[model samples]
Target: MAQGENGSIHENTGERSPAGQEAAQDTSLAPRRRKPWFLLVALVLVAAIVVLIARKPKDTQSSATAGPQIATIKAATAHLGDIGYYVDALGTVTPVATVNLYSQVNGTVTDVHYTEGQMVHRGDPLIDIDPRPYEAQLEEAEGTLQHDRSVLAQAEMDLARYEKAVTLQAIAQQTYDDQKLAVEQYRGTVRNDIGQVQAAQVQLSYCHLTSPINGRIGLRLIDRGNTVFSGASNPLVIITQLQPVTVVFDVAEDNLGQVRDQILHRKALPVDAFDRSQETKLASGKLLTLDNQIDTSTGTVRFRAQFDNNDLTLYPNQFVNARLLVKTLKNAVLVPSAAVQRNGTQAFVYVVTGNTVKIQAVTELTTEGDVSAVTGIDAGTVVPVTGFDKLQSGSTVTIQSMQAFDSGQQRLERTQDKSGSTL
Candidate 1:
C-alpha cells in the first residue's frame, strides 16, 4: 500500500510542475500579445495626425478663397478756361441823388400834389403853403409903390421946370436949386417903395415847395392844412433818384495795387451787386470811382459803382454784396471744387496712377462757380473725387462703376441746362 501511495504523489508533483511551467509560458506570451495593442494605439495616433493635416489644408483653402475689401474711386481730368479772380465784399446801394423837401416860407400846407411813393420830375410841386397873408402884404406894398410913382412923376415935372428957369435966369438960383433937390428926394422914396413891393411879391411866390430832382418820394411827413415853418426840424418828404443808383463798398488796402492796375489797363472792372441774401444779382455796373484817401482807422479804400437801375430793383440804402472782378487768367487749369481738399494752408488732390492712388499738392489761383483754378495739375490727369477719405498715398483703388464716374462728366456736359443759364 505504501509503494502505491508514493507513486501517486510523484505523479501529482510531476503534473503540478508541468502546469506551473505552462503558466509561466502563458504569462510571457501575454506581454508579447499586448505589443499589438500598443501598435494599434500608435496607429490611432498616426491617423489622428493625418486627419489634422488634412483639415489644415481645408482651413487654408477656405482662407485663401476670401478676398480683400476694396473701395471705389472717381477718376477725373483737368481742363483749361478763363478763370476770373473776384473779391467779394459787403456794400450798400444808394441813390445818385437824394433830397429832402422842406418849406421855404412859413404857412399852412394847403395842398400836396404828389402822392406818397410817387415819382416826381424836377420842379414838380410837392407841397403848397398858405399864401393869403403874403398876397395881402404884396398888394399893400404895390399900392404904396403906385402912390410913390405918382409923386415922383410930379416932382420930375417940377425939376424940369426949375432946370429951364435956372438956365433962363427967370427964377432965383436958390429957388431952382431947392426944387431940384426936392425932385431927387422924391425919386429916392419911390425907388424904396418899389423895392419893398418887389420883395413882398418874391416872398409870396415861395409858398410852393418844388422837387429839386427827378426822384421817387417817400411818405409825406406833413398833411394838408398842417402848419409848416421854414425852420422845421424834419422835412415834409424825402425823395430819392432811382434811375441811376450807386453801389458803395470798401476794399482792402492790400488789393489796392491790383485795382489800380485794372483801372490803368482800362479793363472794365465788372462789378455785380446782390441783395442781402447774396443769391440774385440786382444790377451789374463798372467801377466808377475810388475815394481819394484810404481810411486810416479801417485800413481800407472806398469805391463806388454806378448802375442804370431803370428796373428799380436797387433801392436806396439797401444792403448788398459786391463781387469785384480783379483779373482773368487765360488757359488756366481748373478742377471741380469737390476734388480739392484743404489741409491747413495747403491744398491737395488724389491722383490715380494705374490702379494706385497718389496725393498731389496743388496751388489755387482762383475759384469760379464750382471750379477751382489750380496750377499743379494738367489736363487728362485722372483725379479721384469721391472715396478719397479712405485712401492713403499708394493705395490700390478699384473703379466700381464707369456709370458712377460718368455722372461727374455729365455735370460738365449739362452746363447749358436752363437752371444754370444766366444773362
Candidate 2:
C-alpha cells in the first residue's frame, strides 16, 4: 500500500484494484469524450417561441382594425296594386232545360223524321205514328157530330111550330110543352157531340210528334214500325238546350254573407270555369242565382251561373272548377310572399333601412299566388326576399339583386301564412 497525491490510499501493485482502475479510466476519458448538444437545442427552441409570440399580436391587431363583415342578400320592394278576391270551388256544368220526349198516344211508329243527335228547331216534326187508326176515329166523331147537329136543327124547327101552335091555342098546351122539352134535349145532345169532335181532333194530332223547343236532340230510342204505348216509363228521345248553359257549384257557408250581399245588390259576379284540373279555362259567365237554403250536411250552398255557350264548350254534367271573383282590393300594398316569414301565428318581414335590416311585423290581408298584400309596411319599403339563414333583428345586408315585387298571394292566407324555422 502507498499514499496517493490526495488523501486516498491506493495499491501500487502491477495488478491494480478495481476501484483504482475505474477512477483512472474516468479521468482519462473525460477530455477525449464529445460534449452534449442539449443546451444548444434548448436555446434554439426558446428563440423560436419568442418570434411566434411577437408575430401573433400584430396579426391580432390587424384583424381587430378591420370592421365586421357585411352579408350579401337579395331584396325586393313593395308596391301598390289592385288585388282580386276570388273563391274557388268544384262545379258541374249543366243545361238550363232538358226535355225528355215520351209517347202520348199508343200507336205503331210509321216514320222517324229527325236523325239521331240532330239539332232541331221548335215545332219541327220528329216522329210519325200510324195515323190511320186515329184518323178513322176522328172521322167517325165528326160524322156523329154532323148527325146530331141535323137532328138539333129539325127539333128547333118543330119547337118553333109548337110555340106558334100554343100561342094560337089550336093544340093542347101539354102537347106543345112536350115538343118544346124534346127540342131542348136534342140541343143538349148536339152540344155534347161538338165537345167529342174536338177531343177526337186532339187525339189525331198526337200521332205526329213535334219538337217542343229548339235544342240538340239525342239518339233515337224507338225505330220505325215499332209500336209505342202511351205514358212510357222511358223517353223516346232527349233534347237539351246548348246555347244558354249553366254551371252549379257549392260555396262554403262561412262565405255566405259576402256572396249574399253582392247578389242582393244586383251585382253580376263574374265566374270563370276551368277544366277538371282547374288549369285550362273553359268558359266565362255571370252568377245567375243561388239556392235559398244551405245544405246542412255539407255546410255549403249551391250557386248557379249562366253562360252563353256559342261554341258548345259546355256540356251537361261536365266536371269543372269554378272561380268566382267576389271583390277587388284597391291600392293594396304588396310584396313577394317569400319575404313574409311567420313565427307561429305572428307574421313578419325584414325591412331594410339604409345599411341594416330591422324586423318588421306585418298584417297579411291576402295571398293569391307568389305575392302578398300586407298592411304594416309602406308601399315603397324595401325588404330582403331571400337569405334568411343568418338574418336577425339587426342584420347588416348587401342587396345583390333588387326586384320590383308584384302583388298576388294565395296559399299564405289572409290570416297567418308561410313560416320557416330559420326566421
Using lDDT as the measure, which candidate wins? 2
Which tens-of-lDDT digit does each residue in 31-139 have in candidate 2?
6663446667888999999999999999999998876568788999898887767788899999888999888899999999988889899999988988898889889
The candidate 1 region of ten consecutive residues with least summed lDDT is 403-412
Cα-based lDDT at residue 367, candidate 2: 71
- Candidate 1 Cα misplacement greater than 4 A, ranges: 1-69, 144-198, 265-267, 399-423
| CA deviation > 4 Å runs, candidate 2 | 1-74, 337-348, 355-359, 367-371, 384-398, 404-423
Q: Model 2, 330: alpha-carbon shift in Å?
A: 1.8
| Candidate 2: pairs in clash | 367-409, 367-410, 368-409, 368-410, 369-409, 369-410, 371-408
Please give the distance, in angstroms, between residue 338's alpha carbon in candidate 2 and its true position after superposition: 4.5
Candidate 2 TM-score, C-alpha based = 0.73
